[model samples]
Target: MTVTEVLRRFNRTYTQRIGVLEESFLGTGRPLAVSRLLFEIGSAGAVGVRELRELLDLDSGHLSRMLRRLEDDGLVATTVDGADRRRRLVSLTTAGQQAYDDLERRSDERASSLMAPLTPRQQERLADALATADLLVRAATVRLRQVGDDDPVAREATRRYVAELDDRFPAGFDPGPLAPEPDATWVVATSDGRPVAHGGLRPVPGRDDTAEIKRMWVDAGWRGAGLGTRMLRHLESLAREQGYRRVVLDTNGTLTGAIEMYERAGYARIDRYNDNPYAEAFFEKELSSAS
Candidate 1:
């Protein structure tokens, strides 16, 4: 079978085995969605309604209906903030906390049952594979888009990137605000509307056919998920689209992970081409038209 077919088959079996199709989940007498929402609120103590909606990627209308149902059942309560009446906060009631505890216990029981038949080694393997799969799926869901350098999200990403560099490099790094220039492009990778990775390309000084990759960074929480490599490839594609034949980047030697990723992505070590004080290693790659 094709890879897509195999993935779809696994997904179907996994969902069914996990009782995701059940009308009630974990025997909580509520649908999976409601149970999941309750779990989030219980874990967080209290959460803003808008934040919950964003976290769950639920439509406002759907979320409101769910909250109303929970409120009617005396499982949840909502209140408006005195400082901001428009902002609604949600919290689980005492009964809701009990229900959440029950759901957690039942969920643990279900997971234990699933693993009971497996040997210890097999269980370890399954856990490792699941972790890898989860990270890969989360990375795949990140959306990359080109944005103006001055865009708030893009600016925020660059600021974080610089801050991280300052912390990591022996000599602190500080960069000026990104200025608009021809053939320059900045891209941000966002997960759930929050910037998680960013990179940019700009024309190389005195070289019309070359671009320099700058400010490539992934959030610390997201670093090991292959997001940096993905962002690098995206920057290369953007450079190609802008008619550049080559791309170069410089990095501090302390960033071994980034250097390794660049090497793996076909970037070759090169002599320093720029006078940036923070750069200790330089690399370059020839871009293909197909990108």
Candidate 2:
């Protein structure tokens, strides 16, 4: 099957698994929204209303109403932010703390009940699949933003990427941003509003519309979650969006997974594009004008 077909098949199984845990866990009369709020607030002990809203992506009025209802039910209380009075912070009341524990206990019981029918081996397999699904889906949820490479998240991603390369390249690697060109777009991927991966595509200094992808990186936990491929696709799409017809990149021989990804993603072998002390393999992909 094609790459798209494989991804689609996994995604369907993915959403079904998420529905089972995140949606089915809420007992009758409780929607996922309220339960999620309670879980977050419960975990934090106390959280700023604004922070919750931002984290949950809930609108102002809606978040306020949820906190108000939690308050009415004696589950939570809100106070002005210590440093910023205008900001309202929400915390569980003593009663709410007890209730939160109950919620957790019941949720655990339900999970256990669901797993009871399976044999020990089946249960183990299920657990592993669930863990893999969580990581894959969580990774797909990260958004890529176009920004400057020196930006904090971007820099962190670059640093991590170079560190990984340094480990692979016996001769060491260049830690600088894409050799600095006027035409480059830096894209960083973030989960929970924190950077976890990044890459860049900059026009080859003297070439017309030909650019190179660089500074690719993904966090340790997210390494095998298909993020590197996604980041590569994201950079290719970005290059195409900027009217380029092709994207080029170079890599050291030691990073096998990255090499495989580029090969599988349709990047054809090319000769050395730069003598950046660490490069061992070079590849490029042509884009259709319609892209």
Best by TM-score: 1
For candidate 1, what is the total of clashing residue pairs? 0
| lDDT of candidates 1 onward, in order | 0.87, 0.79
| C-alpha RMSD by candidate, in order | 3.6, 5.3
Per-residue lDDT tens digits for candidate 1, residues 237-271, read: 87887788999999999999999999999999999
TM-score of 1: 0.79
Please list the residue runs of candidate 2 whose C-alpha ends up more than 4 Å from where it truly belongs after superposition.
1-31, 44-54, 71-96, 139-142, 148-156, 159-183, 191-196, 223-225
Q: What global local distance difference test value does model 1 have?
A: 0.87
